[model samples]
Target: MNLNPEQITDYANTFIKVLIDYSPKLISAFIILFAGLYIIRLINRFIRRIMVKRNLDPTLTRFLADILLWVLRIILFVSFISKLGIETSSFVAILGAMGLAVGLSLQGSLSNFAGGMLIILFKPFRVSDTIEAQGVVGTVSEIQIFVTKLVTANNQTIFIPNGSLSNGNIINYSLEKIRRADLTIAISYDTNIKEAKDIITAVLKNNPKILETPAAEVSVKNLTDSAIQIAVRPWANNEDFWGVYADTLQNCKQAFDDAGIIIQPFFKESSKKNNPTEQLE
Candidate 1:
């Protein structure tokens, strides 16, 4: 079908009319989009400065700023679409439903991320700090977004989910400058308790790693069927804890041997002797 002059003119007129009608909204949307992007940048920079001033962790700062930037941009995008006379309620609802689905599917990951954020913010433990948490005792090597890496004394690397780590009991041994080392020394019932205590006390005092300000003490902790338990309390710097502990045990054992005091390993053997069922196992 051939278009007449009137038909061509009418089509042109209709196109011009539509453009004229939507020109302001289109222009406004473009202006708002650019302006909103600039504003978001400024806001992100301002937030980063504030976080830095507050001494927040660098990782958390970047993560939070990125999240905020995206959230703000999403809102701005919705507003821009609304400015173009498009219905946004359905769009927002769809977005919300999609967000819910994603959140549900990544629930554990989100929880771990939140846990990591909390841990970084609160600093319950720091890198290189010896901490006991979730039944694992190790030095924290890295604190990631979803997990914390720990290096055990045996040089084993353990990855603990931040969710459980943040929620569980954390014993930070390196948080304090000083720590007390508790050792239970079991001696034969026939040995002299006072002499054993004196010898242990001397050993603790002689060790340079042990702190003298608290005055190390040795006392009777318990008495078993065949042995007397002595509790040796020694104070040392956090870094010297393991060293002092090992030295104390070695020195005490040597001292006991020299003093003719018997260190008994009778608890398990005595139990086995008393329980005939143990041998069967």
Candidate 2:
């Protein structure tokens, strides 16, 4: 079909008129889009600086800043769409539906996120703190949004979910400035308890790592058929706890040997008795 020139001109004029009518709104939308993006960036930077000044956890600071920027950008985008003669209610409804779907599918992740927020806000433990949770003990290497990383004493890395960590029992060994080293050693019942205690006490006193304020003590804790259990309690700085523990045991053993104190081998004797022929031999 062939159209008349007049009809073609009329259609062109009508299109031009519509464009003219919407020009201002279109221009305003573009301007707002650019300006809103710039403002969002500025706000994000300001928030980052504030978090840094407050010495907040690096992971939490970055996560919060990114979330704030995205939320503001979403609002700005909705405003821009509204300016271009689009109803924002439908857009918001769509977003809500999508969010619900995502939340349902990632329920565990959302729980971990909430747990991480709690950990960051309350600070139950911090990076570099040695903590025991969920039957695992390690130094906290990093605290993340979903998981916490730990490095064990044997140099094994463990990733624990933040959800369980937050709800479960956590023993923070590094929280205290000082820790007590509790060790038990067995000596033959024939050994002189007073002399053994004196030797152990001297060893504790000679160690510089052990804290003098608490004053280490050695006492007979229990008596069994084979030997007497001696409890050695010493206090030391948290950083020096393992050192003091190892050194104390070594020093005490040497002291006992030098003092001629006998350490009974009860388990060995019991095993020998279990084998009548070996015991007889």
Candidate 3:
């Protein structure tokens, strides 16, 4: 049909009005979509840079940052989708269901992760500290997410579950600045306590390994039928514990014998026959 000039102008204006109304919607959708994705990338990079600058642990910093960035990106994606008239509630429900399924599958790993977090935060022990936990005594080497690594006294590497460590008692020997090295020296009952004590004191003094501040202690701790048990307690730096322990034992024995302090062997019968009062003491 051939339209009049007025009819043609009216049709042209109507088409222009339609385009104008939809142009804003198209632009807004594009801006929300592309800009949201770009912002997510920029934010992820920013978080990584900040974490690195803070000197955060490589593992923890990276893990947390990645999680945060993913959450932000997901939010932006939902916003963008909503701008295009997509329903976010169904997407959120689907994501929640997937997350629940994944979480259930990773239940054991999540337990280890929780246990590791507890260890990191509470700090019951640290790397290189000699600790007794999970029925194992060893030097802690690392506190990884799934396991607690240790180097045994014999230099064997052991990986223990953090769950067991957290539940059990943790005996950390390295935490103490000074450790008491205890030794029980048995001398013949006939030997004078004074002579034995003097001999032990001289041996401790000659070594100079024991701390002078606390002074090496010598006391007659027990009087058995077969022997007089003298308790020798020496204080030494934790680092030199083994050296001081071995040398002090040898020195005490040699010095006592040279001083003519007669020695006696400890017997199970002797301790067993002791009076109830002495046993309790």
Q: What is the lDDT of candidate 2?
A: 0.87
Residue 154's C-alpha lDDT in candidate 3?
72
* The candidate that achieves the highest TM-score relative to the unseen native structure: 2
Of 2 and 3, which scores higher on lDDT? 2
Error of 1 at 238 (Å): 1.0
TM-score of 2: 0.87
Error of 3 at 146 (Å): 1.9
Local distance difference test scores for all models: 0.87, 0.87, 0.80
Q: For residue 190, what is the lDDT in candidate 3?
A: 78
Task: List ranges where model 3 is wrong by over 4 Å.
Answer: 1-88, 102-107, 267-281
Candidate 3 clash total? 0
Candidate 1, residue 28: how far the Cα is off, in Å: 4.2
Across 30-74, the per-residue lDDT of candidate 3 in tens digits comes to 898788778778888898899899976555666677678778877
Model 2 pairs whose backbones collide: none
Clash pairs (backbone) in predicted model 1: none
The clash count for each model shown is 0, 0, 0
Residue 18 lDDT, candidate 2, scale 0-100: 98
